[model samples]
Target: MVEGDPAAPYTDATRARLEVAFAAYELADLARAAVPIGEHELSPDGTGRSAGATLADAAHVLGAARRFFEAAAVFERMAGADWELVGDTLGVSARAARDRFAVAEVCFREGANGPRGETSWWRAHLAEQPLEAARDLDDWVLRHRDGDGDLGTTPVSGGLVRRVNTGG
Candidate 1:
């Protein structure tokens, strides 16, 4: 379990990621519809970095954004959304839906990346395993820790659950 609220980390990240994911999806849909994309140097409030500088960058952005969306959707499904409902929404079988979530759980948690964002940097080089066949959660969590020696975690069901030291 996380030090405080188990769902906090995932929920906080979900909102922002969902926005980006939806935007990416919309952009892709528009492009497929032959809608002309007006050129502009779109930067957030005061961010010096431009959103997309090249075709390759845009492609990468869309791909990365979509994965976040897919991962978030999987997390949502895990939170009491039945496999049949997930299957209907994702257009897959119930078993496949569960499998996808299982794979997502492993992808979302296990890895050498310091955290979620860090994984993006080495996505091409890293190969993630399916959750059912992946390493045990406890082993993975023990292997990955933050700079403060604190490991960021999300609540998972039916496995070795660790009680985080709150240091209260």
Candidate 2:
């Protein structure tokens, strides 16, 4: 449980999972903003041209959105969320919801068993520096360059970086 918060009812594990889910939600919001609506004119260099988000850019945003959604689903489940509620929220049947997030759960578990587990890192971050954790998530979402940067180099709080292996 988070310290100095008398109103917080969740255990530490649940809070860590919820933090990850919140981060995923933030990432999803960023991905949504990255989706281009219409064509825009590029700066004139020798020839002025109209350019917008390419098909590949749109596809990458879609893929990132899907991954963020899956992460939210799996983390919420880890935090003791009911499958029926998750299904209702996602507009799917409970079984279908479980099936859809199964891969994410497997990937999370595989990573959790590794030496440098994301789950363990989040837990430690939450326990040691809760406020910094929130700031780190905000920084990550704001500075994230989808498909154009290495995750291992993205700095977070305490001089640590993120390293995601989704097993794709």
Candidate 3:
């Protein structure tokens, strides 16, 4: 639904929101498919449905829910939503929401393979660290326009090197 040049660079916020929107669309499609017309009717005695059918529906819905939650968590992080705000939206305690969504946020950032060097560090660190390590790296990449510095040559050690500028 997000129409634009595929090669055009997008800010992390835009990317995260687009991902969430896509995931929501997928979830809606799955929900519709899970209850096809004439197939979801339940009798008073519950005799029309087989155990397999019920289990399959349950699994499908659960999977879709998980994907939606992960996408939402990623979007919230990229939007710089505070844990308390996230918790209120999810009807949970601030600490509980943060604990649940931290891994998803970290995974989304780590999985991002952009031309820029900002997220490259996550890949290396995530590969060597346990998933629990994600909590420690929360908000490591600031999700704002000024967060990522301009790409240019900078001095490293004693010599100038071409790289993403870290506004130091």
> Best candidate per lDDT, number?
2
Cα-based RMSD of candidate 1: 14.1
C-alpha lDDT of residue 23 in model 3? 53
Show the colliding residue pairs in model 2: 1-12
What lDDT tens digits, residue by residue, belong to model 1 across residues 70-103?
A: 6565556545577788888878898887776565
Q: Distance (Å) between predicted and true CA of 128, model 1?
A: 22
Work out the TM-score per prediction.
Answer: 0.35, 0.47, 0.53
Q: Residue 77 in candidate 3 has what lDDT?
A: 76
Candidate 1 segments whose C-alpha is farther than 4 A from its true place: 1-54, 109-168
| Residue 38, model 3, lDDT | 58
Q: Candidate 2 lDDT, tens digit per residue, 1-168?
A: 133343433343344354554556555665767654434434445332534445556676665566557667877776677778789999999888887876667666544421223344564566566556656664765575577555443233223223233345
Clashes of each: 0, 1, 0
Candidate 1: pairs in clash: none
Q: Considering lDDT, which of the candidate structures 1 and 3 is the better prediction for this target?
A: 3
Which candidate has the top score in TM-score?
Answer: 3
